[model samples]
Target: MMRSIDYGNLMHRAMRGLIIEVLRQVEEGGLPGEHHFFITFDTRHPDAALADWLKQRYPEEMTVVMQHWFDNLHVDDEGFAVTLNFGDQPEPLYIPFDAIRTFVDPSVEFGLRFEAPADDDEDEEEDDDGGDDDPAPSSDRQDAEIVRLDRWRK
Candidate 1:
């Protein structure tokens, strides 16, 4: 029998809603205690809005810390916007829900990872290229440890 529901998608949506709710609370009142967020997103996603320089720097993905430095945070159903400092220069970023790869709050050891949608136009031949493939970690992720939730899921 065909599965009656898309449980994975539903779970993802619920988790995304949790992030929104947390942001809403933070907006009303500052983070209580040591709460903070580490949000990683796909820079190449069409809905991601970032500075040209930032795009050039983090070509594939980028992560941002929403702690003591961010400002003008606005979250809507579709996405969120906030300004963060990059080398003493404040840069505004807009990231859609679809672009988010992960969200974590290390203070509480809470985290979630969302799978990015596959690109339909990708060439199959490009997958066979054998080259030096040392994965470069995102700069913001260096010190931000996250608790992954994959094992908890069936």
Candidate 2:
């Protein structure tokens, strides 16, 4: 005999909930020693909000560095908000938990992948030096690009 079951959507929602919980821990207790996160998400996600100028600047995908001077970090049932210094200006951004596609910290070898909406275009990863790899700046941030985490996919 064969079994018939329906669980795709259920599993998807459950996994999403788990991802949010982990983020909540980081927001509440703070990131573990030397363990910061490289979070990647769709800039166009409905719940994602950024300065209009920022959207034009990043256009498609953006990665935020969550260490050092980040502040006002908050997370809730639907999304999260945080403030970071961009150049000489402080910028605030709100991104829904659902928009987060990849969360990882290479320093600790810990990572998580979540369902992510499709990106309409493909672009090169942006280095931390305000553009691609540059020879002049040595303080540029370099992090792996996070994308939709599809763990169960074959």
Q: How accurate locally, in lDDT, is each candidate?
A: 0.69, 0.62
Candidate 1 worst ten-residue window by lDDT: 124-133
TM-score to true structure, per model: 0.74, 0.65
Q: Where is model 2 more than 4 Å wrong at Cα?
A: 1-11, 115-154
* Candidate 2 collision pairs: none
Q: Which candidate is the best by lDDT?
A: 1
- The TM-score obtained by model 2 is 0.65
The alpha-carbon lDDT assigned to residue 126 of candidate 1 equals 19
Tens-digit per-residue lDDT, 11-98, candidate 1: 7778778888988888788678988887878777677899998888777677788888888888898889898998899999998877
**lDDT value for candidate 1?**
0.69
Clashes of each: 0, 0
lDDT of 2 by residue, 90-127 (tens): 99999876566566666656565443223223354345
